[model samples]
Target: MKIKLVAEHIYNQEFSIERALNWILNSMTSEFCMRFFHEWLEIAESGTQQLTTPSWKEIIELKEKSFSKFNFRFETNSKDKQF
Candidate 1:
């Protein structure tokens, strides 16, 4: 799946990043936002970039690391067993 699709899917889960983004980064100064956007755009456009597909363990670790306050459980359904 595409990176955007994966992000959307994850965002649709209980832990919403939209609210977090708005409260954290979006509330920052215009110069900070511009710099952040420019950096993100540059990394996205960089042809040499390569992202490895994350394993379930890595995903869980990331979730735990980023949102330690929330309890997130990941269940593997039949459709997701392949991962």
Candidate 2:
């Protein structure tokens, strides 16, 4: 869900949609998608994650292996969402 929204927002243009999907897909932590993303890119001159086809198995695997951390900032009235 998050990926879809973020990808759409980032790549609102049809021309850039593929690029946006690839970025999010590569950002994922799955052995399958991680490797496959690269392979797909290698085959195609440009990269796209095939977002139309959702792979549940790969998503679960990515979620399980998702240990990488990213720093993000948030604004809140009570407190700043600090890292």
Candidate 3:
């Protein structure tokens, strides 16, 4: 999935896999990720929405809600690191 690949790419390291997974999980549900990407794409397509990336604080509060909702766990190795 897009989330997994992006997360791994950004957070790749032996000790950072869990952090990567957690961040990916956090981002998928974060308002900053969802609404921002949606609106950003819309704007990119039509040139009508705000031009700047929104603040992370816009979704800071949603972190807890997002975190509590997902419980996925898995093992990863360098073999799974294929781009």
Best by TM-score: 3
List, residue by residue over 4-57, the lDDT tens digit for candidate 3.
766466645544666766766666667445665665555455543555543566
Estimated TM-score for each candidate: 0.24, 0.23, 0.29
The TM-score between candidate 3 and the true structure equals 0.29
Cα lDDT for residue 34, candidate 3? 69
**Global Cα lDDT for candidate 2:** 0.47
The local distance difference test score of model 3 is 0.54
> What's model 1's overall lDDT?
0.44
Best by lDDT: 3
**C-alpha displacement of 75 in model 1, angstroms?**
57
Inter-residue clash pairs, candidate 2: none
RMSD of each: 17.2, 13.9, 9.6
Query: Candidate 3 at 20: error in angstroms?
Result: 1.4
Worst lDDT run of 10 residues, candidate 2, spans: 74-83
Q: Please report how far candidate 3 places residue 32 from its true position, in Å.
A: 7.7
Candidate 1 stretches with Cα past 4 Å from truth are 1-28, 47-83
In terms of lDDT, the poorest run of 10 residues in model 3 is: 61-70
Ranking by TM-score: 3, 1, 2
CA displacement after TM-score superposition, residue 26 of candidate 1 (Å): 10
Model 1, 1-83: lDDT tens digits are 43345445554553344553443343344545465555545444552455545456754554444432322333433444321
